[model samples]
Target: MIKVEQLSFSFPQKELYTNISFTLEEGQHCAFIGTSGSGKSTLIDILMDPDRYLFDGRLEMEPGCSIGYVSQFAQPDTSADTTVFEYIGASFIKLQNEIESICSEMETSSDIEPLLDKYQLALDAFDAMGGNDFESNIHKQLNLANLMKRRDLKVSDLSGGEFKLVQVMKEMLNRPDLMIMDEPDVFLDFDNLNALKQLINSHKGILLVVTHNRYLLNHCFNKIIHLENMEIQEYDGRYIEYNFSLLQTKIELQELTLAEKEEIERNENIIDNLRAIATYNSEASRGRALKARVKFQERLEARRIKAPFVDIKQPEIHFGIDHDVQDLTVLKVDQYRAAYDELLLDKVSFEMKSTDKVALIGPNGTGKTTLLRDIANNHPDSITLHADAKVAYLSQLQGEVLKDSNTLLEEFIDAGMSTYDEIRAHLAGYGFEREILNQRIESLSGGEKNLLQLAKVAVSNADLLLLDEPTSHLDTYTQIALDQAIQDYKGAILMISHDFYSVVNGMDYVLIIDDKTVRRMTIKKFKKMIYARHFDKDYLELEQQKKALETKIELALKATDFELAQSLMDELEALIKLL
Candidate 1:
């Protein structure tokens, strides 16, 4: 059990949570939620590294309680040229090494066997840890991922999302008492996300995950610790339930406030009447009436109710889409192909109309982002857009587009928005303050930067909008705002996002990138397809072919046989085409 009370935290520039209290007792699986950059991650960090963060609070963990945390911010040695299998099976290796050490010592100290007892103990520990079958477990995990063929692939060769998955897999293998995962939903498609969900549900240990996934929060977490306004509020149950109850309470409070106001008005009227009566009567009566009225006023003041919540300033997002009518087909792709390390998309064909709202979704490292960028760059003959179409793109990589010289305020202005007052007022609706306007672009939180991009999108009169992971940094309400805006948007939008709820309701259709297939279907159909696609097969075969071809090509090159090397390279490419 872990109990936290009256916790207050501050960073170099901002104070986060103050006087916050919550508990993660046995059998209570929970989640952390708040506005983007509202210090949800900071709270998790405080829990993971209690000695690192300075805070004023009472935090007590059960004695000898173990914790296994998985966070996106965690850095593994990715630069090392280690195979996926070797890296994932590292725990087994460490155990084997320990066992070998004990045995060697035992052999050295014979005839009374000083190290014999230690050796037996070590062997028992290894057995308990399932050291004998751990290698097979690693193989099993890889097979589940349809990555058995890539087991020999170097860690450095995998995509960013793939690396994250590998690290998470390693942590899951550890299986400690308490597990904390921060944004595990990012970079994962519906298939991998479901797999992760199953794993979390099956784990008997306590889980404290911080994710923007609405489905996961409502389904997995039994409790929610909400961080807001430098304070914390604990909800006893799921998000949907808590939000509903909170709404009911807010309504009741509003009604009660109105009733109290009416009561105060009636009392004032009575007091006025009494005063009037005394004014026409004698001096003694007048003085008595005044005193009575003062007492009555004091009582009314005592009975008055304070408002339950402060009015939170939220930034408003409104996209002013291009109004000019143009060609029906805004964009089209014919036989598109691009690759980083492996084949991402091949012979992919698609077309989008002027008013179409589409979502592109796929598993991690499946090239959703690459496809979007290829379209945006209008990659030579691969992509075709209507000559007159105006385009606006909000990339998932906000930091890449934004420059160091610009402040949040400047970016808003440079995006062709109106006066600073108009822009700042708009930002204020999304929770930006006056002080936040002057902050450097780099200093802004992920959500804040995302909002800034949305704010820019709001002013642009582009006919087609390309948004990648737009809802990643948005809080629930903010996501709702964006969703509504997208729904009402006149122009078309092609987005790449993992926001399940938004993608389901906001977009007209979905474009699922499953390996080499580019499927255009409704959200419902897309989900069903992904569910069926989750069965991992065909991967091992293609990967083996790729590996063998790569080995031959390398050997040929090493022998200085250019003709043979070229032939092998061609074979490798053909194998990749199959994948």
Candidate 2:
């Protein structure tokens, strides 16, 4: 349906892509992935409206094909009073109305030929869109998303995450030739994420999705378009299989590179010795041997492996604590009550001791953000902070903690702890370039802003950290880095997250907001809860075995023993069947 060949694009400050090429065929679900600030979203913009930008490329879409788009920050129009069902069926309704109007005009018009032609066009469009069963299709999508009860709800009344799902259903039901969704999984809860997976899997048309959610990456896409090192690579296979292929190739190339390095070093030593002997003996043969060794060394250096795919640079993220809180209780909340349009949280209580790591989790719009804010603000009646505790917060709404008008440099300098040069160096570690130091915070991608927030939190030296959905916009590599940072952090942390891997792996326990109150659940129970809801009954056990077998396979591959590797792969295949 769509093809891009040798596409190259750049901005004044940075060159994003150089000769990137890919294709989207019917029934292929493509996952567009890249590191934060790698211009995946920008590429989507180019695809959606090629005329808006001047670039070098051949971008072609078959004639008469239609495109559907969902932006990264799509929100329902609050001023509109459209119901969810009406919104989803808007396209079908419009065509139906046009056909009816044309028929009415035919009843009295003198130019009957044009009216008949218009009627035929409208009918064709409606039939192509499945208008005969549009309502049933809408209900089916809503039911699959578990939003049937909210079909009559105003689009303006839905939560942000719910509205995102509604947007997906609206676009999918329209049955456009190609659908492009940019980070549509952001801010969605566990159930919604699963629902999104189903929607992507069931989509029949061509799909190009920009996402970083591991679950979706594993389950949704059949093709991978990876943007890295100012280039693009396409893999016509599952992401898991593509990833394994990359790993295997990287391992082999690394071994070859290591051998080349040893040869170069040995040649260098021999060359030095030969030159020294030639200088002493004035021998022509010695000089010629030295020249030969030099050439060999140069050749080895030229052919050395540069594995961009495997050697992708990851942001260095470390949450450092200068000192530990001596207080037994770092924070405590009792009888906490908060409300917006209605009472969302009532009599909610929770506490965290020093060095404790806990996750605050609940459904979307369940006052998780409100409770985190109250704790950060130190509400006198219900929330308490120890006298010895110094707290730092990373808000889900990046704008709340950062000024849109300020430049990246100015924002960091406002902290009064680092000089201009020092701040620039620190931001570099978090993957910000010096050229964009004066760039406004508002211009950054969502992942970049979240990364900046993480950089700030890293330097706070606070003994208590409050993080809300820290992994929402981060790329997978950065997310894994954050998981490690959270695991290694010495301070007490109360984080609000819907990412199941982060919760089950990094957190000590979970503080679940249930029935407008707070309760604690062990990590084991939390794992069980997720496995039961999202996987087969035996999936958890089989997944564990698979991971172990994968580790053994990696070890065998590292030893360059294909026999052992194949044996482990067989075991893994059997375990995967159970999963």
Candidate 3:
């Protein structure tokens, strides 16, 4: 448990937060929700006592406490030459050492057996912590990240997303009493995100998360803390509540503005009447009226009404048109086998039509990215496309294109051709400021850089687009904007994303990759298949009959009819086997 009492902090040139008071009850899970640059991370740092910024209040912890923090970026010290397994396994090693020390202190007792039991417990803990599945999970996460083949590679060799996944696994293993994570869903696919949600739910300590991922925020956090305009406010419910509260606040402000305008007009009318009477009378009796009018004017001038400027402007995006097709087959892969020491993708063949919006869907390590890259590489030779077909590829890590020397604006300009004003206006749509436009690309956050990347591509004229995890670092509003833009595009889209909502809502067709093979299905049919597998609805009448038999067996057992119960149980088991 922790408490912040009247905590105030300010920067040298700007006020960050003031009079921020909040408490985290034992086992409370809270989320910090606010726009970027709202001091969320800064507040986390203050809570953890890392680097002391300007402040004027006290943060109190309940007696002695330990805290664990997971940053947005991976901070693994590459100079130490550590593998992913070694990094995660160290937590267990420390816990095991502590258990051994405690066991040695309790000498000569029957508790020895129970103490030794801890070793088995530790082993089970390790296994459950993903020890045996460690390498597989790593490979899966990396492959979903489009960097699987580089397992033996050093930490420094990984891209940003790859390294971020490694750090996420490490944090999951730590399992600290007080855990604070900044964007835990950063590089995770759907399967891994589900795993992470389970881990967080099963965690027995405090969880303080700051993430823009709506699903995670809605599923995990019970309370929301919003930071805005140098103040921290608490919302009583989840993300949806917070969103509704924001809308409510806007409406309240509008009402207040109307009230203030009416009040001002009423005061002006009174003042006008008083002034007119005073001017006509020219007598000392009218002095009190004039004084009352002056006082009203002063009160009106002194009144401070709250009014916030909300920008509701939407972006104007123009998607390129699809030209006439020269051939129906847009892409094909025949007898394609690509792997590294082991087969990742084997003999996969697929054909694409002109208007196809194909989604590559699968679990993390099924080599979805490999299949996509293979398609992109084999597109020219294996299949014929429209004569004017142009492809725009957006990789998961846009840092490859954003070099260190290039400014945000400079990178947009270098994307080949765009007018100066056009580039500026487009960047503004993506939340880039004039000051940030001149900032070095290397200095921007992952989310900011990704937005700039989208801005570049959105302005480009291309008939076919290939996007890999385009919604990874985007906020909900930005994600909706992207969804709208994609829907408006007449061009064919080939995308790989882990956001289930985006996939379900936007995709028309899906390609399921499993065990080195690709299975094509319509989105509706795929949903039905998934439901059938999960709930045994594949054969609806058979499932219903099985349920009826199960209920009859339960009733028979309650009636103390041994023969009937036994017979029914046996028949039910047989039916289960047959199904």
Candidate 4:
């Protein structure tokens, strides 16, 4: 159990929290949702190190209990040359070393009397801490994630998603009493996301997580802690339920009651009478009486119902010129093959009409970004655009679609906007303040850079927009803003995003890339296919083979036999090729 009382936090220039309180008990999954830089990370930092900074708060963590923390964009130890297996065992090194030392002493000692007791005690301690089954837990998670092949791969060679999985697996294998994860669903595909969800659900521990993934919020968590406008709002239900209640509360806060309206009217009448007396009656002795009456009425007049805080306005994105395409057929692709050092996509074909709103979705390490880049770079055989089509691309991978050396102000100016004030006004919709105008593109966080690209796209005169993971790092409010912009867009849009909410709400068509099969259909049909996996014989057979291979690889790795693990990998690869 963890208890936070009257918690207040501060940085060099900002006060993040003021008098916030909450209690998180075991077996409860509570999430923190807010806009970017709303102090979710800072609160996690405070929890990780209670005495690291000065704050007016009492954070009581249960004594002797362990904690596991997986921060956002948390990387593995790349400098240290180690495999996934070795990295997972890094935490248990001390116990293993102690056990080895005790056994060595017992074997060498002549008397062997004292050494025997020491060895027994050390073994008991190691066993009590679950040191014997540490690798077993790791292998289980790795197999479930279908990452058993990555066990022998070096930490430095891991992709971002792979590194995140390894770090999470280590934390889970540690068996901490509490697990705190930040943005765990940032770049996950369906399979890995399901693995993470299953892991969280199976863990019988307290979970205090912070994420913007709506699926996780709606399905995984039962409680929500929302920080907005410098206020903390606690909801007793899950994400959907909390949203419903939040709408009702906002309506109540905005509307005035009949009694309150009448009270305001009465006060206005009193103020009018008092002002009349003060203005007309100008006698010397009675002047003080009139002044007092006016002052009292003024006070009463000032006292009215204080309006609730309103959120900052969502960014108004005017995406592209309102030029409708007469020909209608915006783009066409036939038998597309994209490759960068390795084959990313093979034999994939798709098309887009002038009014189409499509989403291309796949796993993190797949060729979604590669396909977008090929289309943007105007590959000969891949893209067939109309003569009048104007193409604009937004890549979440920084420096791909933008020059990082340029300042935000410079970028906005290059977008053909008028003046500095106008630029700030435009950027403000994406949560940019005046201070950030002069900041360079490289200095911004991933989320901010993505938003800057969005702002640029908003003002462009493109008839087609190809976006890759546009909402990966944005907060909830900014995502909603972008969704609205996409809805209002006149041109055809083809985007690649892992955000379920954005994909469901903003996209009319979906292109699902799974197991090398590309399926483009209505979002409604794809959703049905996802929920009810009544796939064809080929897909079902491939899935069954993959599961069986994963199980076999899991058992082999649990025994820590490298030869067997490698053999299973060879077989798994052969089986994948057959698919």
Candidate 5:
């Protein structure tokens, strides 16, 4: 078990968590969530190396507790030629290498006794670590993750998502007591995402995962640790349950607060009348009543409800266009072909309407990002655009759009904003504080950088937006905001995304990259394809029903039907458990 008490931390420029406390019991799988740049990853760093930080806290962990960490930005060395099987069995291989080295040394030198002892020790340790069955174990893990076919592939040859899964597999093979994965679900496709879910659910050790993947949050974790507004709210239940309870509490509190405000308004009106009458008639009783009412109003104001955690702040992301495209086809690609080390795209063709919201989806490493980038650049040989169309691109790699060394203020100014105050005011809407304006872009979190990218995209006033994995690093609320923005956008959008819900709910249809060609699929077919691949129809239908019930329950709570709301909530809970 791990326990923290009254933990408070701050940087020179910003305060993070304060007086926050939570405990991670032996078997809890906790999902850590918060706004972008709210220090979720920083908290994990502190946990991994408590002595590196100076903060007010009491953090206690069980003695001899082992930890395995999968960092968000960790990548396999491209220069290394290790295969997946060899990489996962590295420990066994290391022991084997040491034993072989000792035997070779004994043959060459007069250190036979010492070498034999070392070899025996190495053999014992290897056997104890199950190294004798290392190959079989590695193969079993590969099969479980459905990567047996790729077991012999070089780790560096894998896509980012595949490499991330390989990293998870490598860490899990170590069998640590606790595992902490930061944003492990970021670039994963549907099938790999399900594989991650299975890994998380099947792990016997503790897990503290930092992620905003709704699918994983719903399916993997039993606990939630939300860091928002410099406070921590830990829930000892599934994310859906915590979310439902939180929404219910927020609704009830908001209603009560609204009623209180109304009452206070009435009292203020009465107080003003009493004061007016007292001033005109000079009556002592009227003066006393006015004073009494004033005091009552103060008391009421003092008792106003403040639900900081529930009233979470969401970035205001809006994608706008200055004008509509005159032509029906905003973008067109015909017989487009591209290659990198190997053929990625071939004879791919697609066109986007002026108002089309299309998802460009395929498995990882299928040239989705490549295709989007090429279109955004308008490759002269293969792509064409409407005469009136202005394009804005948001790259999955933030660095493609944002300069790392530039400060936020400078970045926005360079993006065409004129003045500091104007830039500050614009960024404020995206939840960036004024103080962070001078912070370098590289210092920002992945979410913050993406938010900055979105903020930049919002001002481009382009009729065509090429968004590659726009929702990957964003928080759930910002993802929702983006979905709404996409829905409401008057411009054309060809979004490359792996987020299932975002694609299904936000896009009109999908342009799938299959067999080196682009094929248009209706939203219905897209959903069916996804459901067939990653989920069952029953589970999908149940999830849809669950969402409807949640909406109804919220409405019942708002209508002040306590009994009905309770019944609906109970039903929702049962449904959530089933899910």
Candidate 6:
């Protein structure tokens, strides 16, 4: 439990917050949602007391409460000579030591028996804290974080995703009263995202999470704290409530705009009357009226006015007319197989038309990227496409391209472009200002680098676009702009993305990958399948049975019924197999 009152913080150039107040109750799960650069991270740092930013606030925290924090870019302890098991098992060791020390003291002195009795509660507390399921939980989370395969490997050899998983596991092992996670879903795939959701849902402690993943936010959060315009506002309900509240705010803003317009007109009339008096040679009266007019004009200008939202302007794309390829297939793949001990894609075959806008969709690790690479490689003959068919690829790992030793502007010009002004203008459209345009490519953030790549691809006048997770680090507003740009492009597209809203709204065809096979379907048909699989009566019944079984297992463990726990676990495993 934590409470803040009259919080204020400011920087030299901008004020981030003023007179903010909020309370986070024990065992509450709250999400901080807002636009980029809106001070969400700043508030988190203030709460954690990491660095002394300019601030004036009274924070009342629960006495003796411990807080565990996981940052967005947490790196694994590579220098430590410890296994994953040893690291996670350390928590149990500490708990055991405390319990033993209390018992020893009680045995040595009769005066300590009452205190010893209080300490004796540790074992039950530990058990209730998921001590029995600790190993399973660690394994589950590691697998979800894409660290399971490397569990036996040293931390130094683990990938970014593995390091993130380890950090999450470490926070969970501490069993703190409150957990604060910033961008926990940054490097996670869909499987890990689901695992994280399940972990959070089952967790008993309070959680404050900051993430831009809509899927995670929609599924896990019950309360939303929206930070905007240097103010904090709370929504009593979940994601839906936050969204509806935003809509209401927009309506209120419209009404406010109308009232301000009327006020502006009134002020203009007063200024006109003052001018007429000045023309009639009434110097004293005119001067007094002019002063009044000037004061009113200043007040009107000082009022914070919201700029009217205008959609991003998409440039007219003309895929140069080279040749009529009505009969030529734009893409073709056959007998593609890739795997590490298991086939991820087995003998997949598909063809793409010049006009096809296909979306690749599946659960994580189902070989979406592998399939794309295979298609891109096998279609070399199709490369010399329609004279106007220039191809531009946007991969998830586009940051790798930024490793080149060139300034951002230099790279844009070197990529077959001619004009510096054109490059600067396009980069600015993607939120990069002139100062950033001259910076080295390696100095940019992931989001900025992504935007640069998109700008380059867009300017190439490519007729065929290949995008893989293009919207990962982008905010919702930017995503909408990108969607509009893609919609207006007079070219075909093959994209692999996890953003469901964009995929559903922009795609015309769906290609579902599952169990090493590919099935092409219309978007309408794919939607029907998803609806039936997730929301049908039979699926609901199955889900209810699964929940009941999970509850039974939890009760068995809490009761110290190991045999029952094992039985229930076995039954649950069988039920999962059936599903």
Task: Give the per-residue lDDT digits (tens) of candidate 2, residues 355-469.
Answer: 8999998888899998888777746688888887888899988988889899999998886656888988888888887678999999898999999999989889988899999
Q: Is candidate 1 or candidate 5 better by lDDT?
A: 5
RMSD for each of the candidates = 16.1, 2.9, 13.9, 13.6, 3.2, 13.1
TM-score of 3: 0.69
C-alpha lDDT of residue 108 in model 3: 59
If the candidates were sorted by their TM-score against the true structure, best first, what order would they fall in? 2, 5, 1, 4, 6, 3
Model 6: lDDT of residue 117: 66
Model 4 error, position 503 (Å): 2.6
lDDT of 5 by residue, 1-579 (tens): 888899999999899989999988888999999999889988899899999999898999888778999988888899999998888888889889998888888889875887788889999988877778778867777787888899989999988878888889888877778899999998888788888887888787889999999889888889999988888888999888888888778767877887898999999899878877876788787878888889999999999998877787777888887664454988889899889899999998878888888988888998888888887774757899888788899998888999999999999889899999899889999988777888999999999999899999999999989998899889988987887788788888888888887887788999887798888899888888777777755676687688678668768866877678778877887887777
- Lowest-sum lDDT 10-residue window in model 2: 538-547
Over 1-579, each residue of candidate 3 has an lDDT whose tens digit, in order, gives: 688878888665446777888877767778876655557777898988734666788788865467777787655575877655555556765666665675665565656677677667876776655565655655555554344455556765444445665565556555565778888787566556655665566556787888877667756777887666667777666665565445444445555666678888888888788788877798886888778777977887677464322223333434565355343655555666667756777767776665677788766556666656555445535344455566676766675546768987788778875676877887787667676778788866566566666777776676667777778666666676677778777667788987655666577888887778777888778657655533244433454465566557547644645567556656665655544
lDDT of 4 by residue, 455-504 (tens): 88887789999988788767766776787789888789989886655776
List per-prediction Cα lDDT, in the order shown.
Answer: 0.73, 0.86, 0.66, 0.74, 0.86, 0.68
Q: TM-score of every model?
A: 0.80, 0.92, 0.69, 0.79, 0.90, 0.71
Leading candidate by TM-score = 2
Location of the lowest summed lDDT over 10 successive residues in candidate 4: 304-313
Off by over 4 Å in 2: 107-113, 281-289, 325-327, 378-380, 538-579
Cα deviation of 135, candidate 1, in Å = 4.7
- Judged by lDDT relative to the true structure, which candidate is superior, 1 or 6? 1
2 or 3: which has the higher TM-score? 2
